[model samples]
Target: MTAPSPACREDVRRTLAYLTAVGYGGTAMEVWQWLYRPSRAWSLEEVMVALDAQVAEAKVDVMQGRYALAGHGARMADRHERYLSSDKKMQSARWFLRVMRLIPGVRAVAVCNSLSHEMASEKSDIDLFVITRSRALWCVRFFALLPLSLLRRRPGHRTRHPICLSFFLSDASLDLRDVHLKPDDPHMAHWLLSTVPMIDDGVFADCIHANAWARELFPNAQSPRVAWYRRLACLRPLSWSLPFWLERVLEQFQLERLPSEIRTRMNGSTDVIINEHMLKFHTNDRRLEYRERFLSLARVQK
Candidate 1:
């Protein structure tokens, strides 16, 4: 389904709603109270007020200190739903995570792609990059995510690759992050910065990724242009696959990860794999890595 423009806000809202339902035992106030980090520095009252705006129109009753997103949020998902990437997808993801938490074996869950800017209008999949604790439960989790993945795929979506990015699912031998993420290579982080939270219990933090780092690495790079040309190359007469050449061109900036976001976008627009957005942001706190790396590199280079 064509994800809506306000998918980010809507999904986040619905996700907060669902998590509020599960996270604090159906306590919307508690969910907000917890999800938003308590900063004694910021105006707590204002934060609570702004969050309350979500329930302004809904029929959710905050009895004592708990509330549900039942009335307004659910109604919007049902009535206003235009695409799977709409707030509905977020609701589905939230529900999926809620279910995961209840499952005895599951460890933690995360929601990536919540803020992805794809190249295609048609999505390839709603990537719910799940992280769990056990290596043996990999198969069990696959079976667990099977029906849900099918259910979560965007409308008109041909593929259903809800990738489980766990050390267990990938390779128990390597660090889970290493197995899921290609490497914390300077090339990758330099480009991505989009991220969101799923069920962060300090196992992971709210992280984001962007393609700006790719631009930084290839300072003279005009990837969006290159992406267009490479896309044309794939369709032109007497052409083999354009990605091979494009990958060669983008080797320095991790053509693999760099193209990931774009490819995911392409899956939306055309049938071609447009390199999946050049970045796949997992929901973790990778904020300082960028700054720290720059400083560390500057020191070494000097």
Candidate 2:
């Protein structure tokens, strides 16, 4: 077998450094797929060989089957334990999202961020990216959160499981690049490419097609895997559709509860855009902050 090149070793090193900076530790195969992009293609065996060489050179460290920077051997072990805990959390989340899909107008449910990338910590929220029908946004959210509200994980309370319905979009609003994306937004770009669809309902693929702009920034980002689709069970159809008057009533009720500033942002727009497709509860959107942090670290690394 041919020895891995200097460039290949450097790529592997940089990959580990970046991932470790974000508190994500990976196995050789995880690193391999993450490295499997359009710009710098590496075969599974090539990645494995490069990883082994890096370990030999004291450039990378592996602990409990997880790999990280040479200085983070102990942290990698802790991360591995968290990864194991995350597996059980994912199972519970899957069950919740499964029920969420059965709600009327919900088109898809996807696991996003750290969990999707397989690096979730013990306290990582179960981030879900949802797609809903064009006009049933408020109704969809009300029903979707009805059960989740009971299990809010309480502020500052500890729990191995917590569901975060942070992001949502309507079928007609799938093209988020022009609407939400900013230049050099690595977190958003990586998020688009890494979402794990638990309840596709065919809308997940459409969302991807609509967001082709991500390909320009992250040409090497991994595509959505089909294995998640095969596991979805057919949801039972809702017995009765919400009448327009009832939806309006619910929207108004919800509006009464929302902060005045957020209501001002709504500006009386209550259809799929404000009421259904655009329900974002995470006030502190961290994508920009994370992008700036990662870019600063990358520059320092160079």
Candidate 3:
């Protein structure tokens, strides 16, 4: 087989390296969809040809229609098991997002992180990324969490499918580039591309457009399309007449009840951000860790 061009080979290697770091493999289509830091846009045909060349060179392995770095075939069976787990989690996420739509001010709710990538394990908690109306950040969060807390579905509840509401962005702060780790943040770029919106009021599209910078990293990646079956219409009428002051009240109430760890870490940096436009409570952010692991894998491959 003919060798892939340098750029194609590097892109293919980088894509596999990142997926391997996350303990997953990719089909040809997924490699194309999650192409990382490509020097330029690459067509699906081109990516397939590149992958074929890598396989011929013993640099990559293809099993059951999935591709991974050589000696990594052992993960395919585990990935399939996780795929089954993800299906059950997705059903739970869809049901939760449906209820979330009825709670006013919620513009969009997306299945993110491990679940979004369909790599959730049996013990994994569902991670959701929420988008709310400009000034309804806290109100939407309070209402969204109240029922989940009551039902013991939130994190720490020991539920089989606990939901983790760690990230929220107001419509006014749709652009997420500011929150990305400095220098090169490949994980953040992929995270943005992987989000699967379950409930959308047009805000998901706006958020994707706002973060056009991701294209610089994933030039060929397209915004994920929410299936017609998964898309739930928002009940805007419920929040239409809500007083603006109510947001402040809810914000204060939640702030006072926040655990000391979160309160002390609030606004310390992007990891535990808390402001009028965004609420991101990732006390143990792993973007940097993932980036380092991906780089280490890429180096070993070289």
Q: Whose lDDT is greatest here?
A: 3
Candidate 1 lDDT over 1-302, as tens digits, reads: 22223322242243344333222212333333333212222233443453455446452334334444433233232212233343334443444555555543343343333212221112334454443333323333444545565775433335433433321121122122221223333323322222233443333322221233332322322112112322222111111222233334443333344335443554242222222221123323343444454344333322
Cα lDDT for residue 74, model 2?
Answer: 77
- Tens digits of per-residue lDDT for model 3, 115-231: 887889999999999998888989888988988999999989879999999999999888887889888788888888889887776778899889888878888776787556544
- The parts of candidate 1 lying over 4 Å away from their true place are 1-86, 114-124, 136-140, 149-193, 206-302
Predicted structure 2: clash tally: 1
Task: Return the TM-score for each candidate structure.
Answer: 0.31, 0.79, 0.93
Kindly give the stretch of ten consecutive residues in candidate 2 with the minimal lDDT sum: 267-276
Candidate 1 at 190: error in angstroms? Answer: 6.8
If ranked by lDDT, best first, what sequence of candidates would result? 3, 2, 1
Model 2, position 90, has a per-residue lDDT of 75
lDDT of 3 at 196: 83
Q: What is the full ranking by TM-score, best candidate first?
A: 3, 2, 1
Q: Regarding lDDT, does 2 or 3 come out ahead?
A: 3
Predicted candidate 3, C-alpha RMSD: 2.1
- Pick the TM-score winner: 3
Total clashing pairs in model 3: 0
Poorly placed runs, candidate 2 (over 4 Å): 1-3, 36-39, 150-160, 179-181, 217-241, 259-276
